[model samples]
Target chain A: MKAIGSFKGEPITDSDSLVDVEVPTPDLAEHDVLVEVKAVSVNPVDTKLRAGAPSQKEPLILGFDAVGIVVKTGSNTTKFSKGDRVWYSGTTKRPGSNEAYQAVDERLVAKAPRSLTDEAAAAMPLTSITAYELLFEKMGANFGQLANPGKTLLIVNGAGGVGSVLSQLAKWAGFTVIATASPANFDWLRANGVDQPIDYHDDLETQVQGLGHHFVDAAVILYDVPSYYDAVTKLVAPGGHIGAIVGTQAKLNMEQLKSKSLSLDWEYMFAKGDFDFRMETQGEALRQIAQLVDNNFVHTTLSRTIDSGLNAKNLREAHQVVEEGHVVGKVVVSGPFNGQVNE
Target chain B: MKAIGSFKGEPITDSDSLVDVEVPTPDLAEHDVLVEVKAVSVNPVDTKLRAGAPSQKEPLILGFDAVGIVVKTGSNTTKFSKGDRVWYSGTTKRPGSNEAYQAVDERLVAKAPRSLTDEAAAAMPLTSITAYELLFEKMGANFGQLANPGKTLLIVNGAGGVGSVLSQLAKWAGFTVIATASPANFDWLRANGVDQPIDYHDDLETQVQGLGHHFVDAAVILYDVPSYYDAVTKLVAPGGHIGAIVGTQAKLNMEQLKSKSLSLDWEYMFAKGDFDFRMETQGEALRQIAQLVDNNFVHTTLSRTIDSGLNAKNLREAHQVVEEGHVVGKVVVSGPFNGQVNE
Candidate 1:
């Protein structure tokens, strides 16, 4: 099977950053599904791993978000069959979906949205799973029931992929969404169901206060850890919830949250996948997410798509595009050598 | 009205640290109650105020936990009548309850427990208010519902005034309580209803893990911030909640909470009184707590009581006891006289 992997940290611009190699496939367990990868999206985790993959005996496969078809199913796998379209964010500790044929636990895979294209569906899994878990699972949003109708959620860095989807989902769950985006994306954010889109460049505390809301019921941070920590802390109401997706190096004086009795939480969506806990819930969440997309309640964040066959050159270019840091949504490498997009 | 106050920060050993001074009677508002203070408990807050009290135009009166009788009630006050026995933790911004007569908002006052003596009642208000809010209000422990029966709560520093009361309340609320205390206080901690009293002198994580509670549902921390932060991060269950009453000058790396999706909260119970939020709830909680005490579901932690007359010398001695930090539970100063423990 053809795979894209790295042995050690390297700059994305270097030729050896991500290499195309052949790796032998392993025997499948009773709960595994072998997927023939058709399309995959590059996320920040891809770049992070590319630059930080540990030096080990085996090469580290790099992609997490992929849309593919079940080519083989284990005897115990009942949810999927051969030729079933699926989308998933695979586990971090195992071989990722960068390979042409990747064997994964059936529990992590979900039926892809039939109404959307493979590229669009590929972009949804990792970010959507993270946003969904952070809002509904960890923060106790309760998607099965209507969230507080007038409750406000402040989404920091609202134009990013996860924040974009989270805004729509929070709105879908009945919350009045307040998102922070750049000046250029204000109209785009409001168009995508955000009730109010504030400029991330301004003083967020002042802006939130000026909105006549003394504090937001909850806040989700998608980017800008050090700069936005205080702003989020100041904006949350008494006993309000705050979840940060990214990791930080410094200790953040949690005492800041004491006055309001604010709850500080961290959401790393891959933990359950890595630790093997209720892994089937990921598939269930993805299935529900697909329905939401099909019903037009949520939209994909595919900014652009390229076709160059699943190889090293195509992967490097995709990494370069994402590394530029101004992606409107997502960039996907798809197709079996489509002539123009590849050229 | 005669009161103990200080115009500036000074050592408790200094004769002028807390002086008896006569000030004009406070004017009563529509919902205010004029109480003749009968007894007062000296908490860390009193010492804190004596050292950190703001230099104001008028002298800053000190003391928070107080038990008294309502001498007068203003118009629109319906909760209590003249001669009603009450206890309260005074508002942070207002003149405190350590005086011959103190005017307090009726919402901050609750009927004292009929079964408790004045000293015992005074020892409860501040600690009870803090513990109740930390458990029910901050961490959302449902005292009204037995939803998470047999759930574990790790209370750090459980032999202190607030911890002693909190351990019993957690037990009453159907949680299996694990408390951390010094070796000397182990039996006392167990006697206070803690199922397990681990020594906080060693690694708290290992000690708790040895007891078979690898992770806890919630935690209430009273002291030792730097040592406990890492242990709390490790011992808190995934999606568990932690609340603390201590202040920290050092920054905390909140990313530690990301993997398990833990919640880190700080419970400043005075916030409600300081910010004037749901003030009536404090009185209501105190009233319910009084009932719990009357029913013997809880007990006061008045370790030592001084019939110290309302004067500078006696108040200074009470402050000294709290400052020494060896006193268990509460040290209260009571009665009225010409600057002596006995009238």
Candidate 2:
């Protein structure tokens, strides 16, 4: 199979940053589906891994969000069959989807929405899964029918990929949404279900307080974890939940959260993929997300499309786009080869 | 009314550290009870308050755990009548339980155990309330029957006032209790119900792993917040709950808790007392705890007592005993005054 990967860390602009190579396509297990990837999206993790010089014997393929078509199915596969279109956020520890053909656990892959194009579908999986898990799973958002609609959500760094999708989902789930972004993306974020878009450039706590809400009932932190610990601690209402996906080595003063009886939860989407539990739940969430998208209740965050062929040069271009740091929504790279193509 | 109180921050040995002061006895308000305090137990909070030289125009009486006889009840009082034996963990922010005659909110007081002495009853509240809230409320330990018993709890600083009771409660609730204490108190901690007591003097993580339980489903840190961050983080089972009662000013690395989806909860028993919500529940838990003691289901940690004559000199002696750091359970001082006193 033809794949794009990196062995050494370097700037994406460097010629050797990413290389086109041939590697053995993963063998399908009982629950595995062989997917021929058609479109893939670039995220911050891709650039972070590329710049870090990760130690690896084989080249590390660097794509997680992918839209593909199943070409073959293992004997025990029950969810997908040959010719089925699928979308998923691939496991973090294993090989990724910057390749022509990839084998994925059938439990983590869901049928692609018929209403959207492959590029649009590819951008939704990684961010949607992250946002979904952070809000509903990690934060334990009550989905009971009687849940109050007056609850509030504060989404920090709200114009990013995950935040953009999360804002809409939080609103759909009956929360009044408060999004934080720069003045530039205020209108865009407000149009996407945010009740208010407070400027992130200002003191976040002051800005949030200025909006007349004393505190948020829940919050999702999308940027640096350490920078907003105090702000989140102060802004969260008593007994509220705060979820973050970002990692930090800095010390966290757990005591700051004690007075308000606040709870801090970390949502790493990779846990399920790496630990191999509740994989089907991710797939189910994806299918439900697709239905919401098809019903025009939620929209994709694919803000830019770059036709970097599924090769070293194009992969590096995608990497550079993510590293630029101000991606409005998602940057998806369309296919160099259709799902039907074989080596 | 005579009370022992501190006007300045000084060692307990200082002659003037605690002075006898005459203050006006409080008039009973609606839902108020006038109790004649007979016995009171010393807790760490008393020492912490003493060390800080808490501001007070008049001398400030510092003790939260007390047992007494109800001398008078307001017209609206329904829970107890005059002459009822009672015990309580007083409000941290309010005037505490160190005076000859004290007026207490009717809601915070509970019926003292019929089978136990005043000192025994007083010894249970502050620690009992802290432990009950930390386990059942903060850590979400199910107090109902058919609770999940497969879980394990690692109680750091298990020989302190709160730890001494929480270890037994965790065991009674069917959890595997792993407590940390020094060699001197190992036998006492085990006898109280701790299945395992790792010597906190050694490296905590290595000691915990050496006990064959590599991780815990929940952890309650009663003291020494800053020093145990690493060991607590490493020993937390995936999707575990970590609750701490003490506050730490040091910044912590929040991202270390992300991989396993661990939750951090701070339990300040004082919050509810300060905010005035469901105050009756404290009394109810205390009443139930009294029943547990009457049936010999629980034992008091009070080990020593002194008749302090309700004066500053005797109060200092009580404080000295608590400050020595080797006291296993609790210290109590009874008065030569007409007040309800129970331990």
Clashes of each: 3, 26
lDDT of 1 by residue, B1-343 (tens): 6788898888889887788877877879999999888899898988987887666657788789999999899988999999999999878788897778888999988999999999999999999988988887767677753445968999999999899999878888888999988889988898777999999788888889999986788887789666688889878776677788888887776677777667776777777776666789889989989988998889998988888576788888889999999887998889873533210
Question: Per-prediction DockQ scores?
Answer: 0.46, 0.44
**Judged by lDDT, which candidate is best?**
1
Q: Model 1 lDDT vs. the true structure? A: 0.83
**lDDT: worst 10-residue window of model 1 chain B:** B334-343
Give the Å error, residue A266, model 2.
Answer: 3.2
Worst lDDT 10-window in candidate 1 chain A? A334-343
Q: Specify the poorest-scoring 10-residue window by lDDT in model 2 chain A.
A: A334-343
In candidate 1, how many Å is residue A85 off?
Answer: 4.6
Q: Which candidate comes out best when scored by DockQ?
A: 1
Best by TM-score: 1
Interface root-mean-square deviation of model 1 in angstroms is: 2.1
**Tens digit of per-residue lDDT, candidate 1, span A233-299:** 8777766778888888876766777776677767777776755656888888899999999998999
